[model samples]
Target: MNSVRNPVLRSFCGWLTALLVVASVAFASGEVRAASFQPLEIVTQSGVQVFSVEIATTEEEKTTGLMYRKELPDGKGMLFDFSPEQQVSMWMKNTYISLDMIFIRADGRILRIAENTEPLSTRIIPSGGLAKGVLEVSAGTAQKYGIRPGDRVAHPLFNGH
Candidate 1:
């Protein structure tokens, strides 16, 4: 009975170890997690443009924003929340796709727009004024949607909504 029980315990331990190893590999490869997306809208002169944006609220999420992604569909984006409306800086390190970074004020007004940012660049993109959030979308998105400075953004994070 003791010998049989020992073999069964060892087999269970081995299976658990294998499962942990696979999980570790998937996490290290950055393929095990899916981003959480939220609805956002921009009211421009043309009309209201909607987007499904992933909110990056935590330090870790902000640090890893869109890194290693191969593509970003049109009307999809990531929103980085830096509350209290302070000047923020961003870079494209490890980012595979170019983006248009929209700096939004605390009142949900667009402060500035950095369009056609180079991918994988380490150059610092600065918000010219105080901003509470930064929205990153595919390159050329702003031009296609007629997004401009002073446009209103409606989301739960800002006062516009």
Candidate 2:
């Protein structure tokens, strides 16, 4: 007798759960803005690619990197400075746009490139080793500009050479 009602209840529950998930994501995606702005560039094999970057130097700033924004223009990014050359990790969390994480050393050389990070994911993206900074750019920026692990990051936090 109870089995007859089970399918209807399950269907209703599924719809409710999906609605809840969508609403949660929508709320989570737009809670913060970039802390500060700076001009940064990468000396890639293709050429010098300039970017308008948001500098995240403090804990609060770093934690808020590019969250809640639905769109990011080309050649723009958020730079997260870890400093002191330590192992670092990043995640998508509330970010709405996929990004390319460019892990940088203190001397301003690119160390690793984690491209096309899934939006809103909480997956831990590590630096693979010690990194002094990270630059988060819109997805496809790395391949589009030929930016690679050995590229040089031109910014005051790095060597800037």
The 10 consecutive residues of candidate 1 with the worst lDDT sum are 26-35
Candidate 2, residue 14: CA error in Å? 42
Cα lDDT for residue 146, model 1? 98
Q: What lDDT tens digits, residue by residue, belong to model 2 across residues 1-161?
A: 44436888889988999999887875576545556688998998888999999888888788877888888889888889888899999999988899999999998999999999999999999999889999998899899889999889998998655
lDDT by residue (tens digit), candidate 1, 1-161: 54435878889988999999998876556443335889999999999999999889888788988887778899999999998789999999988899999999999999999999999999999999899999999999999999999999999999958
What TM-score would every model get versus the actual structure?
Answer: 0.84, 0.78
Instruction: Extract clashing residue pairs from model 2.
Output: 29-68, 30-68
Q: Estimate candidate 1's RMSD in Å.
A: 3.9
Q: Per model, how many backbone clashes are there? A: 0, 2
